[model samples]
Target: MYAIIGATGHIGNRVTDILLNKGEKVRVIGRDAARLQQYVNRGAVPAVGDLKDTAFLTTAFQGATAVFAMIPPSYTASTFRAYQDVVGISIATAILDVGVTHVVNLSSQGAELPRGTGPIVGLHDQEERLDVLRGVNVLHLRPTYFMENLLANVPVIHDYGYAGSAVRGDIKFAMIATADIAERVAAHLLARDFSGSSHEDLLGQRDLSLQEAFTIIGRRIGISDLVYRQIPYDEFEQALLGTGMSRDVCRLFVEMSEALNRGLFAVNRPRNAATTTPTSIEQFAEVFAEVYRGAQHRHAA
Candidate 1:
């Protein structure tokens, strides 16, 4: 049996879908029973509970041959790192207690750095804690910047005819689709080819700059003049804070952008065939345009 945390989320949902299609028994763990109903109907055992509750996670993880784990994003947390640590520690403890033999952890590319990587520091901590488990084989899947993150700019694109961020328009880096990440995770969970604790970096089809990304998106959406502006760090932070993000999360996001601009994420990491995926910017642009049009129609209604 496979146990999946964050089962209703983008990555988890795809993971569960693939597993169920392959005729594997799946147990899904999430906080909302209503959201998990679809998976339950499809033959997954639903385990609804808080991630921080060790007892809940222990019970959910029990009797599973392997598990997919992640710390769900919490924008409302008073302190981002503290919240990540609590969730991370709880997951590690439960995996150990339940004696699950294999685990695939969702991590980020910058998790190799000890500090200055903002929210990714928490993932680094998770890797370290989970690595010490004696009987468990852990594989940390480190994916680059998610292309879906562009969805956050939909409102700004609609209102201002542009998208903006603290990142410079010219800095090129690997960006991946969450679907691709899910594919790799499901493959690993099924094969169990990896032993001991290790990590693999999932870089998308190619590297791209924010300007190039926006150009592709604009072309797809029929906006010939759409622009991507690099907002000042302070202004970006203020905007996120205004959106109800806690101070710590706002600061961490800014730090993460700064780190990306500095080329910190790619340090010592070289892209190879193993890290490259199949999705391209043009492919994802179509998906983005579809979502943008849906949002536009909803607003017009």
Candidate 2:
């Protein structure tokens, strides 16, 4: 049996579907039973409860051969690291209690550094916490910038005619599609071949800058010249706060952006076929275009 935490999430949902389609028994874990109903219809056992509760997670992890784990994102936590520890610690403790032997942890690239990487620091600590388990085999997926992240900028581009973020416009980073991440994850969970604690870098097809990314998106959305602007650090933080993010989380995001600008998120291994995945920004532009049109329709409505 496979246990998937955050089962309705981007990566987790895909992993669940892949396993279920292959006739594997899956226990889908999430906070909302309603959101997990679709998976339940497909024969997954629903384990609905708070990720912050160790007892709840211990129950969820019991009877599973392997587990896919992650700490869901939080925008309003007053103290971001504290919130991470609440969830991360619970996951670790439950794994210890239940003796689930295989775990696939969703982490970020800059997690190599213990600090200065904002939310990624939490992932760094979570990796260590999971690694200490005596009998568990852990695989930490350190993926690069997600293409789905640019979905957040669609409204801005639709309203203001330009795409922007805290990232430096010229700095290139590997951009991945969540589907590709899920594909890698499903393969590992199905094969169960990896032993001991280790990690793999999923750095999409290649590196791309925000400028290049916006240009591809522009073509798909029918814009001739879509510029990607680098928002000033203070302005970006203020905008995030205005969107109801907590001051602590906003500060962590700013620190991560600064770290990205300095090229701090580095890969220890050389790029090769094993580390690379198939999705490209050009293909992802189709998804972006669809979202942009929906945004336009919403404004008109």
Candidate 3:
């Protein structure tokens, strides 16, 4: 049996679906009862409880062979560090208590960086806690910036004929679709093999510049005027704050963008079969283009 924490989320949902399709007995853990029920209806054993609840995780982890673990997002916290510290401790301790044989942790690139590396520092701490486990085989799956992140910019691009971010418009960086991450993770889970504590750097396809990405989107969407604009970090923070995000959360995002600017998210590992995803940006756009078009339609409506 496989247990997936944060199962209602985007990547988590894809992982659950893939596992179920493979005829695996899957258990899903989620905070929302209604969302958990949706997974239950899909043939997964639904466990409704907060991931911070050790008793809950302990129960969910029981009878599970391997588990997919992810730290749930906490955007409203006054201090994301404090929340990460507390939640990281809870998750690590709970996973250890459950005695699962293998754990596939969803981690970010540059997580190996030590303290004072800003956003990567928090991920480093999570890995530190997981590293102490002697019995469980833990694999840290570090994926680059997700392509789904571009979906958020669709609104700005459609409405204003451009996409904006604090990132350098011309800086080429590695980016992967979330489904590709799910594929790599699901393959690792199904293999049921343990190589002790290891790290898998998932570099999806080649590096792409935001400016180049805009050109591709423009060609497909028939909007040659589409542009990718570089914004100031302070302006980005203010925009996030305006969205009701906590200052600390906004700061982490800004620092992460700075880290990206430093090329901290690039992968150096040799590409392998596992890292190869069949989907490309063109394919993704072809399928999900309606979402962007729908956004445009909604604005016109």
Candidate 4:
């Protein structure tokens, strides 16, 4: 049996679906029992509890062959790094205690760096903590910027008629669909081909500029004049702060964007066919249009 953390989330949900379809026994873990009910109905065993509780996680992870681990973001934490440490330690300790033979962790592209990568620094710490587990094979799946992140700009597009971010819209970087990440995770968990602690980079089909991505989205949504704008870092930070995000989180987000704009995300690691996934910006735009239209319809109602 495979235990999946954050099973109600985008990547975890897809992983659960793929595994269950193949007749694999899946135990879906999440904080909300209601969120996990659908997976329960779909043949997955629901294991609902707070991830920060080691006892809860240890019990949930017991009797599982492999566990899919990820630290869900806590944007409102008073100290984000400390929160990540607590959760990471809990997961690592539980995996060791349960003697789970394999683990697949959802990490990010810049997780190799020890510092200066903002929120990614937490993921780096998680990787280091998990590395200390004896006899457990861990695979850190480091995926690039998620295309779904662009959905955060939906309100900006609706209100200001443009998509905006602190990073330059002209800079090209890998943007992956969450479904692709799930597919790879399912493949790795099912195959169990990897042993020892290792990492893999999941870049999308190709590098794409934000302007190029927005153009595709615009065409799909039938908004001929829609554009992508590069917001100033201070303005972006303030905007996030106004949205009730913690000050540290706001600063970290801007720093991450700055790092992206400076080409820090892809530094030293060149993309190849193995890293490139199949999903394209054009294909993701169709999904974006559906969401956009749904939001529009809700507003109209």
Tens digit per residue, CA lDDT, model 3, 126-211: 88889888787899988877878777787777667888888888888777888888887888889966567888887777677888
lDDT tens readout by residue for model 1, 101-216: 99999999999899999999999999999999989999999999999999888989988889999998888899999999999999999999789999999999899898999999
* TM-score, model 3 to reference: 0.94
lDDT of each: 0.94, 0.91, 0.81, 0.92
Q: Model 1's lDDT to the true fold?
A: 0.94
Local error of candidate 3 at residue 290 (angstroms): 2.2
**Candidates ranked by lDDT:** 1, 4, 2, 3
Question: Tens digit of lDDT per residue, candidate 4, span 1-301?
Answer: 9999999899999999999999999999999999999989988999988989999999999899899999998889888888899999999999999999999999999999898889999999999988888999999999999999999988888888999999899998889999999999999999998899999999988888899999989999998778999999999999998888899889999989999998889534588888989999999999999999999998889
Residue 47 Cα positional deviation in candidate 1, in Å, after optimal superposition: 0.4
| Model 1 lDDT-worst window of ten | 261-270
**Which sections of candidate 3 miss by over 4 Å?**
115-118, 267-274
Q: Which clashing pairs does model 4 show?
A: none
Give the higher-TM-score candidate: 2 or 3.
2
The C-alpha RMSD of each candidate to the native structure, in angstroms, is 1.0, 1.1, 1.7, 1.1
Q: 281, model 1: CA deviation in Å?
A: 0.7
- Residue 263 alpha-carbon offset, candidate 1, angstroms: 0.7
Judged by whole-model lDDT over C-alpha atoms, candidate 3 comes out at: 0.81
| lDDT of candidate 2 over 171-262, digit per residue (tens) | 87788999999999989988887789999998998888889999989989999799999999999999889889999999999999899888
Error of 4 at 31 (Å): 0.6
